[model samples]
Target: MSVNSESVAKKIKELPHIFVILFCVIVLSAIATYIIPAGQYTRVMDEGIKRMVIDPTSFRYIPNTPVGPFAMFVAIELGLIEAANITFLIFAAFSCLYLMEKTGAVDASIALMVNKTKKNPKFSIGLIVVLMIILAVWGSTGTLSYEEIIAFAPIFVALSIALGYDAITGVAISVVPVGIGFASATVNPFTIGVAQTIAELPVFSGLGYRCAVLVVMTTFTIVYVMRYASMVKKDPSKSLVSGIDYSDFTIDDARMSTPFTFQRKLSMLTLFVGVCVMGYGLIFLKWYINQVAAIFMIVSVIVGIINRWSANRIANTLCEGLSKGVLAALIVGVARGILVVITQGNILDTIIHSCVGVLQHLSLHVSAIGMLVFQNLLNFLIPSGSGQAAVSMPIMTPIADLIHMNRQIAVLIFQFGDGFSNLLWPTSFMVIVCAMVRIPLSRYYRWIIPFYAICFLLQAAFILGAVAINYGPF
Candidate 1:
């Protein structure tokens, strides 16, 4: 009947719902406002890079401005506002995709692919890995896409199910590769490019080593996923969501009977063209949620016309999709809420300053690992790769020099910390993927932990190597 550390800790550990865990974390962050000292750093607009960079030496303590109970609730609203672009894109993207499904285009396509797999089972597994690689490549180039990728998680889940794999396998089929690729940061303008700019290194200069890192991580992911798929195929009882009903993800009887007619082919073509356009925008135009959402709008309209769908039907279907996606959208907003609470507490900078302070006296090699560790912890506070770069890179750049470590290695540490931890953090796009796929966080963690253990080992080895070789174009 009373609150205690043990009971609270147990409750958090046992809590299966991400929503509750997130809110509990928000409450805890709200409490941290009172305990963690408030502080700030002077910021400057660097004309050289045309981006805001911090002056790490300018850190100073500020008066504590702990959030109040009423303000805590308001923070949720503020969080949703700050994250409107993302939440809006979630709705719009789902509507666009659901519109395709309603036109029978997606159904026909899925049914066709399912049939293809039936004829060549080996090719089916190969296709899934190829798809993962394509996506990872997309992420490695700095796309770091959320809406488009997360929206497709269900499709991969359906595909994985068709391939005799579980929903967990399906989610992994998409998420794991993207995480690995982003972590490698071969040519990521957002993470690597920005960090290099801050550190006065040539943009995208360490290409050869980064490419090697990408291949290693991608291979690890592919092997892990393939082995899991093989094990599940041999014994379905071993599936992570073994008892759960996946009928919803299953292709409908009517869809299988509809046949892949010429009109349906046109619809499928539209979907393909739409995806290509998205890829172009992402890679070249550097589109974010709002821009991508606009593409979805345009694509949905064209797709509706292709199928001869009634305008009213399109609207209704879009609404239906939005309704289905509310949970996922709210998860994004709620996850943002946690960050809002932390930011409001003014303790985020204080935490970063304190963490960095401990690393100053360590040896160069150890300081390299410490930078990575700080970044991993910082990922919980700031999940965005570029945003993390902007805030931490300025501080980390000087620390790397101060402790006699290579700045290139410092950037690599940040890249690994931010990208690898993306799949683990509850507040990440991966959480929305888990929610959409109905995989509880606990189960998701159990499934992903081994992959990460291997990931961390490889990352550590790479860090050691980068430090050893001076990993530089500096």
Candidate 2:
């Protein structure tokens, strides 16, 4: 079915277990606060409820302060902000998709690319992998924005349709490769740059090692996704929505009537150049002049008007895109609320202290493993890799030093825990992207488990080997 033909809103509602999972998390977090006494588990339960309610900004600006019951409420508020960011980006991206659809640019682009790769699917896949590798390598220079997912998603969808693949397959092909790149990032400004800077490592100091890890992780992710996609293609009945004939969603009809005008082509070209320039500014120039969304929004408007799009049409498209974003933002916002509540109850600190305390008793070798597992568990609570790094790194680094563990190894542990679970985490942006494309979380989990298991083991083994040789930045 076409995106325009169906009520996307209704589809979102019909998805099973989504709300149940969300509600359960919130309720469980609340219960945790009640069960863990404030005195016993300061990290897990914040007794100082007054601080949180009295000042919401305190939680945003000041780290390590106990907020109590107010933590739940504040978490919800911050969760809203995070949601807003996602919403804004999604809306903007969707707007571009809608316009491209209406104008036929998307179809034309896909048809052109498909014809070139029609004879060899392997070549097409290789091309995608190569591009991801290039993007990952340049990502650290501050040139890559996670927002590329937004720009390329519809293209992936269109290409999959052209290639006689399921829509979910298209989403997977586009997202998983980029995800692998992001996860195994050699240069991702957001993930690696932010993380390494926080860890006090020289900028891009470990490029060679990270690049190697990136290749390993990317290869594993690609093989698994491709295999799962091929299975789904052969057996549509395997899908949750087996009755849906996604093949009818043609890129040709969408583009046939929309002539490729000079202005339209120019606008599209400008967007391409703009994104490249934005990447350069972010990495090499160290420019943070605008959030990636803002940059795209401004460029989109300028291009829209230049292509002679009517004012009303532009406004309508913008609104539609923004509405989708708002929905995503709400989910994120609510999730963040749970985090805030847990923080306020002072349970967060208690939990951290307790975990570290347990590690204190373990032998040095065992302590490293303990730290790895502990960081992974902590990932559920703090989803952002950079945010988690800021909070956990300082504390964990000192502990590593005491045990004669390499600080670099400690950081690697943090990266592994933070990056690997992103494929599975409901709270993660990648998961949100999958939801946007109508890929069921349950199905995604099934497709991804083998890949995740393999990568996790490989990463763990790599870390242990490094520790064994005392080859570390510490």
Candidate 3:
């Protein structure tokens, strides 16, 4: 592409038009409600329908209401809540990241990496890719922050700059790889674990399938990010510039004169041990993950104070970082708002009831595949893997058993539907993360679309083939 074309692409990549896209989706859905005649069982509920306009105050209720012009109001309401929750978490994560930076620990680590990578540039890329896979595997074990952009973002930026790539490439690689890991995770606390547990299946029972998906998705993410980075390296104009230079990220110009002190080393050890313990509590001991985050945050703060850092400075840094984090968080609300509007307008119910009604008519043999397809389609509306699992599993599991469909296959259907769509969904948390890092949705789609398409087909084929081969959970 020419310089002007690359500049245009960069601008398009940074377009913060989620709200506008959502507005259009709401309009299209509303039009569909009328133009696409409702199937026999898909009747809209007038009483549930609430009409309102999109605004800060009303966006939170959008996801729960019925479909129509009024449904837009509901979307706005629900969007607000989703945005708020994500924003809060991001703020908290950024606070932790800032503390890590302030203590000079982050710098020291970077120096070690730079020294190592300076010996071999290709080794650096390989190391980053490997780390991404490791972090992803850790994520699968139901450990580590699924939302790790704050920690990884700066590191990747520094690495990219060090490697002679632009900041955008760093941000893209940092967020995308981990996101694919989360999406493909079989043992993720939020989705797979929760879904399987709810279905009464053994925890981590489908490890083989999940691992296969994870490997495929992770390879896809790494290849795409590396290619994008190469493109930006070849032509800087292709990279989005935030008007910030590499030096702006420097925590301190002076390198650590003293060797790693016992205190600093001790502090690092404590943080590592604490995190591992917290993960143990969360996964094996049945402790809540939020509780783990809270404890870790508290411990990190204590470590900061003990390291002789000024409390006031730490607080200010955290606040500054959090403000940036909140901007990224708001996109979640915009996406969720679309769902709220549709639900409020009763269109979601109309669609679901219609699908179920149709399923009732199909022969049991076909119904199995039909239900799987139906669940995947619903993922478009409900992008949250956990929320979708919660809502769908209860309704689909018994039906699967009743129709003699393998329950394991039914569960896999939910997993595939939830996992794969995450890559493409505009509203998913991972997708918003990509946008926040200025990785154009179109660019992401360009690279991963083929991989995801293949994965989807493979998953569908696997499910159907299982049925054909008389594969049963027993």
Candidate whose TM-score is highest: 1
Candidate 1 local lDDT, 1-474, one digit each (tens): 556986896557543687888888889999999999999888899786677778999999989989878888888888888888889888988888888777777777777878888898787788888988887887798665565788878878887887788999998888778777888888887788888898889999888998999988888888898898899999999987776788988776676665777877887787677778777777788776678788788888888877788889877888888987898888888888878888888899899999989998899878887778899999999988888888999999888889888788888888899899888888898888988888767778888888888898899999999888889883
| Local accuracy of candidate 3 as per-residue lDDT tens digits, 1-474 | 999999897777654566666667767776666644332222221221121111211112122232556656666767777556455656676667666666666667666666677687677778768877876667556455445444457666766765667665675566556555666666786676666666667766767766776786677667766776777767876765534445755434365232456666666666677667777786787765356557557756776776876878767777776666665666667667777665545566557656766876777667866876787688889886666766666556666776777666677777767666665666666565554455555555665577567666766776776677655433
Q: What does the lDDT read for residue 174 in candidate 3?
A: 63
- Tens digits of per-residue lDDT for model 2, 262-347: 77677778678767777766666765524566667776677777768898887777777565555444565676666766766657
TM-score ranking of the models:
1, 2, 3
Give per-model TM-scores: 0.95, 0.82, 0.76
Error of 3 at 345 (Å): 2.2
Candidate with maximal lDDT: 1
Q: State how far residue 416 of model 3 sits from its true place (Å).
A: 1.1
lDDT of 2 at 230: 66
How far off is residue 268 in model 1, in Å?
A: 2.4
Stretches of candidate 1 exceeding 4 Å from the true structure: 1-14
Q: How many clashes in each structure?
A: 0, 31, 27
TM-score, structure 2 vs. true: 0.82
| Ten contiguous residues minimizing lDDT sum, candidate 2 | 49-58
Worst-scoring 10-residue span by lDDT in model 1: 9-18
